[model samples]
Target: MSHENKTIRNTAPGHPRRPLADRIALVAGATRGAGRAQAVELGRAGATVYVTGRTTRTRVSEVGRTTETIEESAELVTAAGGTGIAVPTDHLDGERVRALADRIDREQGRLDVLVNDLWGGEHLLVGSVFGKKSWETPLADGLRILELGVRSHVITAALLLPLLIRSDAPLYVEVTDGTAHSNRRYRENMYYDLAKTAPIRLAFGLGQELAEYGGTAVAVSPGFLRSEQMLAHFGVSEENWRDAIAQEPAFAVAESPQYLARGVAALAADPGRAARWNGKSACSAELARAYGVRDVDGSRPDAWAYFEAAAHGGEEVSPEDYR
Candidate 1:
């Protein structure tokens, strides 16, 4: 509930101008990481963003990290030149989500965008090291992860679809991992893989269901995102991120969550966005290259390319590798 981090800057040079003025957006899991970044970018693009999350100034979720609050996220959105509303909500509760939608309908009458970034997997992964088999992970913990990661998105969409349909160009962005063709067995964990894939499937189902409604739905993944939690896990700041790569090589190829945020904003602004829907998943690197946008570091990290290279026994790569 503080505006301490509210700062504004002019749009980046050579980037598209704001095209979402007066639009209403709902970013469902905007406490941190990609959700927070995307919500701020949407606000910068001139959309009133409703940031909903389990964590507020008064409550913290199971994630245990408190780098940002829903109120802080909303303030950042407002500072970016769009109205920001922080509504505390847990997507698992159907009534709570319905109430959120009701409030939006009463106030804004419609919603133009919906971003589902609900994920609470870190809590479930506790006590299960990488060496442990999938069965060693408790079934209850696995189900909890699925409930938070996947079912929450489903519930939020069901409640918000009415408002989204009211817009002439409704956009649904399901924050996920990897594009459709990625075949890697993500860390040899079945629950983790399922949790990550659920959002993509949600996007696919939503796209088909909303095709006739003139709305677009697609899954998007950030390219090796250096989220606040990840940075902390590696005990490194953005300025010192390169130092952590010695221990976790993936850090060398990381991109900020803002990169994907900008990508989502660009897609939301596209008039022909519907053409890119229909169950397809896209990554920030691919979207940036296609749309001529660059990350804050002035590089586009192709996640698929990096994984493909790694799969084929290539050496550890960095942002320079992509350029």
Candidate 2:
């Protein structure tokens, strides 16, 4: 399918107002999945979006997947009714991130929204990691996860906040794996847990710092996200995703990436977002309830709640109840 068609294929009817019109946003690591969806949703809300990632038409990064690229993400953003600029960047490289910041400052003068969604460590979860103990997991792989999930966000924010603070109502979103409350338990392995939870703490600290400048920072996460990589792991496409539920019943509550994208876009456009979300951690379901957003299928999936019920509650609960 064409980029435009694919981009809008799952988009539901949006708000009538262009709440983010004339605003500028940068979606780091927007080559695919939730990152790409957020870029497109921000664009749909009428913001000029700058998308950055290591993958491009000409080069591929360690993540290894090349089916999606930054150029395509930019096109999808533009096709959704806003300006899109694709800049190939490796967030781990401070020099490259600094150059990106400089370019954005030169072109737009200010950035209203910064989405730090730069994690590509899934490929590193090989035989040594995932279910293995911390000591059993390769030290290199653990460090790499931290580098990709934690260090990259720090680097991007360090370089880009200058331009972001120029806006009157700046918003910074740290996208990670789980909500603050839900992630209290271990997440598969030690390295993975730390890699995911660091963003929440970063958001908490940054929110306090940004408050002086009238900016908001919050951590947002998707619940059972049906990302491109996740779908591939289940060996099913979106069209046949339900097939996997037979093997993994939890998949019944899985949601499209667009669900969280819409929630983040709505949160960005909200006039009182700072008062409601600053320094807080939220999940896609919470954002949906706060913003009156629903998935493209017209359902609000609360995977975390479902999991909680399944784990602790006594009553038999169906996953469909969460959706």
Candidate 3:
């Protein structure tokens, strides 16, 4: 409990310290869902966050998904207690990505955290790609999925890594879907599997080089995230998320995106964070145990542990043990 005073773990009404004060962070793909949560949570810990994505208040990206905008994400970050700057730029475009880095350098001078949360492959995830054989899947769609899910992450990191390196304590988080253990089961098809696992390898390879510059790189997974997209998919609001259990029983284990992002904030706040988590693939559930964060309901939900035992292992264990 050493970080009890530093984190919002047990102190609730008594604790009032923001451990990440003055920290500068960039959360790519912060238009909504996990990315937005990560940005807001970082701001909650007092970090000036640059929330970037292709969508804005005025226009949508090529993906054409509307409703949530980067501008709104930035406003939420600012409301959470830190300065938030909304920059609309597609990560795939090299010039636009570099320009974003330059703007950060001019405004903040240093970046402490770089979160590669940009993934535009939602269509491939739940679309016709599922259950369709690799040979039968549309070639263009498969390539598009790879381009968004894998390449965007690489492009963003390449342009932003220099700014992150300037900070004394830098953290690069590859926000992904599943942990190393879980992803071994295969994610949909060839394209989806490669896209999801590429970031894990990206974090690993980057960790080795980052060691020289005193930086940390890790891939973090959110367990059954009830993201904005997921809520829309299930046709349930946060207050009515439980209702989705009728449609998909597995949804019973779903956790809010805020829970996962809080774990990211805790990782950024830990001074010895690199020593423990560099090059690692961690889940939000376990991180919540180590950190002092909770879901929207104020409970630390260990969704992965529950998944491991009940879903994967088929072991009958008390739900209380995991959550």
| Count of residue pairs whose backbone atoms collide, per candidate | 0, 0, 0
lDDT of 2 by residue, 1-323 (tens): 11221111122334566667768899999999899999999999898999999999999999889899999999999999988999999999999999999999898787889999999988998686888999999999999999999999999999998888777778999999998899998988999999999999999999998887778999999999899998999999989999999989999999999999999999998878888999999999999999999998999999989988897565589999999
Tens digit of per-residue lDDT, candidate 3, span 138-171: 8998898888889999999888987887777679
Worst 10 residues of 3 by lDDT: 1-10
Ranking by TM-score: 2, 3, 1
Q: What is the lDDT of residue 163 in candidate 3?
A: 82
Clashing pairs in 3: none
- Candidate 1 lowest-lDDT run of ten: 3-12
Per-model TM-score, in order, reads: 0.90, 0.94, 0.91
Residue-level lDDT tens digits of model 1 in 1-323:
33232222232333345678757899999999999999999999888999999888889898886768999999999999778999999999999999999999999887889999988667566476244577887788777877887889889988899778777667888997777766355645777778788788888888987776667999998877889888887899888888898897666678988899998888888877898655679888888977787888887778667777775557565645764
Question: Which candidate gets the maximum lDDT versus the true structure?
Answer: 2
Listed per candidate, the RMSD to the true structure in angstroms reads 7.0, 7.3, 5.8
Model 3 compared with the native: what TM-score? 0.91
lDDT, candidate 3, equals 0.84
